[model samples]
Target: MRYVVGITMDKRGRDAVSLALTLAQSTLTSHPVELDLVHVIRGVPPEQAVSKPEREFQKLCLEEAQQWMAKTHDLIPKTIHSTTSVHFSDSMATGLIDKATERPCDLIVVGAASHGPLRRFTVGSVANALLHSSPVSVALAPSGYLPPSRLTRLTCALGMRPGAEVALNVATQSSVLHDVPLRLISLIAFDARSGAAETTDAASDHAKKLLVRASQSVDNATEVMVDVAHGRSIESAIDTLTWDEGEIVLIGSNRLARRQSIFLGTTANKMLRSLPVPMVVVPRFPAPESTADDDISI
Candidate 1:
């Protein structure tokens, strides 16, 4: 599988690159994996139009991108073959999507956006746009996150819906490939409009059945565990659960949306707001057919 790490001349971007490298090394042991480090240079304003200052600014951006590439190259292990590229475009999100489409990468890694007074790692503009439009899966690295020494577990946020099986399959495959344990988790939010006790009981029962069926499909080498979180909201429910380091959460796209479209449901979006660890958004199976030109250049 080919993985592209979107980098910028900043700390968050470097963290994203490092996390991507860690994932590549851990999961691609059996297959050939190629890592591409990319930096997108937003096009200077046309209003500036050929002015000396505009020209100098463009040159400075290119120089900084190159320097970042060099620093990334030094951080990579010699065993992992990699390449670095720069894209010049008007939109950072579009440029990255184009680059991923051109490489046909299976996954794209980026850093969570830091904003607001607290500077919490929220889903930034680029990631938010990609979540809906990207042709492939996207992974978000939290602010100041360092790659774990190893991938200890993959937790699937099973929704007990039609498309949720896609996420289960991904989590199962990752566990088998990386030889890590697999966990199936379902969250049941307490709805005030409904009978809370009955709803919770039904949801818990459904989650247990889903996990049983899911566990049967996995290989013997992979260990499977199950849990269900229940509370007033998705966030509150998730907070009640215990999480360890070296764990990643996998979420499936919406089932009713267009095929292969990355549709983040309400639960998935809520989970992203306070994701404790890295999160991997899994698209639907049988990726949508693309007639659009793939040879996009920045």
Candidate 2:
């Protein structure tokens, strides 16, 4: 698998690169993996030449980007493979998307916006834009976060929707590839009409059934578990669950304007707003030709 990591001359950007390396090493142990470290100079046109002052500014930006890229490269272990490149564009988000598409990377990894008590897990403008526009999967690493020692668990936020099955399949594959356990979670917000207890029961029942089918789709050696969280709001439901340091969440992307673009649904968006750990937003896979007979909803 190939991963494109967005780099800037900052600590947060370096954190993203570190997380990307961790993922590549953990998930692609048997297969060859590549990481492309990319830095984009925003507000600069790729085709146009700049004046003397602007040229000097561009030179400084490139020099800074190169230094950061070099420092990041030194941190990577000798076993892992990586390359660095710089790009010029009017928008950083669009430039990242274009670069990833050109490489045809499987995933795009980026850092959180900035470091602050309130913005620790908050997505930055560039990352938020990529989440909506990128064609490939996008992974967000929290600010000041170091890669976990091991990726032992994959927690998937399962939904009863058309694209959810795709997310499950991706999660299952990741679990099998990394030799980890998979947890299929469904968060049900309390509805005034449905009642809390009833909603929780129904969601739990559906989740168990979905887990059974999802497990059968993956390797028999892969272990799958299911859980249902209920609360007044999505954030509350997610907060109720306990998370491991090595666990990562996978949620299906919901696209509206583009057929296969990466867009978060209401619930997914809320979860990202106060994300507890690193999260990967999996793009909806194309529908299969034949439908199988199964009772699972997600």
Candidate 3:
């Protein structure tokens, strides 16, 4: 598997590298894991000429970026193949997305926004932009995150939304590829008591049907578990669920997103407030209209 890691000169950047390393180490595939560590800097337009002082400043920035990249590269174990580069872009998110697309990477890994609680994720400008526009799946590392000894499980946050099945498929494929257990989770949040039971039950039933579909997609030896978490809000519902030390969450983009693109929905944004583990936001896949037949209520 190939991962494009957005590296900065801060703790958040180190946190991203840590999470990426854990993923690389835990993958069970025969092919070697590769990491592309990229650092983005503000660069003058190719068509524009620069003054001597501006040229000197640019040279200094590049040298400093390369030095930091070298230090970050040394942190990765020799077992994993890795490379470092300095990219020229006005936007950090844009540069990372371009790198991921050019490399055809399986995922883009980045750290959480800096100003957040120690163990939780706060989406910053870069992550927010990537969530809405990245071509590939984007992984967010929580603040102060450290790599676990190994990944314990893979969880798919299944909902009645349009891209729910796409998220399920991606999570299932990852579980099979990495030889990890898969968990299908449905989160129910209700505001009033008027029809909470009916709503919750209907959601649970739909999740079970999705579970059955996921079971059919995997081999007999693969273990698949399904459960539903309920609360007054999405954050509370997420809090009710138990998470393993190395478990990662996978969720799909909103229906409004362009086909095969990512757009973070409101539910996911709420979940992030309380999510202690890393989360991967997947892009919506192109499918027929009939695909949402069983999930029309939501």
Candidate 4:
């Protein structure tokens, strides 16, 4: 799998790099994992003409970007193949989208917005743009997140929605590739207006049926666990579950998304605010199947 990781000269940038490496290394597939470390020079197109002084300033900026890239390059170990480049575009998100499209990468990784609690995600402007516009899946690293030796588990948030299959497919692929366990969770948030026992029982029964259907679709060899989490709200339901240090969550894009593009709904945005681990937003449609040599690019 090839990944396009957005790089900046801040803590967020380092956090992104850390998560990308952890993800790349965890996959034990025959196909090699490659990372394209990219930094964008926003509001500056490469071909635009300018005065001599302005040109000099742009050159200096490019130099600084290259230096930063070099430092990031050193952080990557020999086990993983990586490349660094600086692109000029109107916006950081635009540059990243362009780069990912050019490479036809499998995933794009970025750090959460600053000013959030450590180990939690806060969507920033660039992440918001990608979630709404990018054609590929996007991964967001929590603030101050530092990946463990490698990922140990993949938890897919399953719902009785149209795009749920997409999330399961991606999570299963990752689980099989990494040889890790996969957990399927159904969040049931009860209301005060209803009979608590009846509401809980009905929701639990439906959630269990969904879990059975989902589990039957998986390979028998895969270790799967299913649960129905109940709470007053989605956030509280998620809090009731224990999270592992090396765990990553997978969630599907909204059903209202374009055929294969991503659109983060209100529920997902809320979950993002409370999630303690890194989250991957799967697109509405499954990625096209291809061999490593044919479709995978730098």
RMSD of each: 4.6, 4.2, 4.6, 2.8
lDDT against true structure, model 1: 0.75
Which clashing pairs does model 4 show? none
Question: Each prediction's TM-score against the native?
Answer: 0.88, 0.90, 0.92, 0.92
Model 4's TM-score against the true structure: 0.92
Model 4, poorest ten-residue lDDT window?
Answer: 289-298
Per-residue C-alpha lDDT of model 1 across residues 1-298, encoded as one tens digit per residue: 6778888777768768767876777864566567888888898643454888888888887888888788887888887878898888877778888887884577888888755112135877888888887767788887777778988888889876687776776677677776778888888886678688887777778778877766776747778988878888999998898876788888888775567667777888998876688888867753433213321100
**lDDT tens readout by residue for model 4, 1-298:** 7899999888888989999988898877586789999999875643463777767777788889999999999999988999999999888899998998885578899998877689988789999999997788899999999879878888988777666867876776677777788888887777888677876677667667756665665556467787778789889998999999999998889999987688998888878898899999977874454223223211
Q: Is candidate 2 or 3 superior in TM-score?
A: 3
Q: Clashing residue pairs, candidate 3? A: none
For model 4, the superposed segments whose C-alpha errors exceed 4 Å read 45-47, 195-199, 287-298
What's the true lDDT of residue 38 in model 4?
97
Q: How many Å off is the CA of 40 in candidate 1?
A: 0.2
Q: Estimate every model's Cα lDDT from 0 to 1.
A: 0.75, 0.76, 0.83, 0.82
The top-ranked prediction according to TM-score is 3
The residue-by-residue lDDT of candidate 3 on 1-298, one tens digit each, is 6789999999889989999998888776574579999999877633342677777777788889999999999999998999999998879999998888774477889999888789898899999999998777889999999898888888888888665877887788778766788999888888876588998899889988987888888866478999899888888888889999898888889888888678998988988778899999887862233124222100
- Candidate 2 residue lDDT tens string, 151-207: 878899987666677788778877877778899999888767767787677777879
Clashes of each: 0, 0, 0, 0
Full-model lDDT, candidate 2 = 0.76
**Model 3 lDDT-worst window of ten:** 289-298
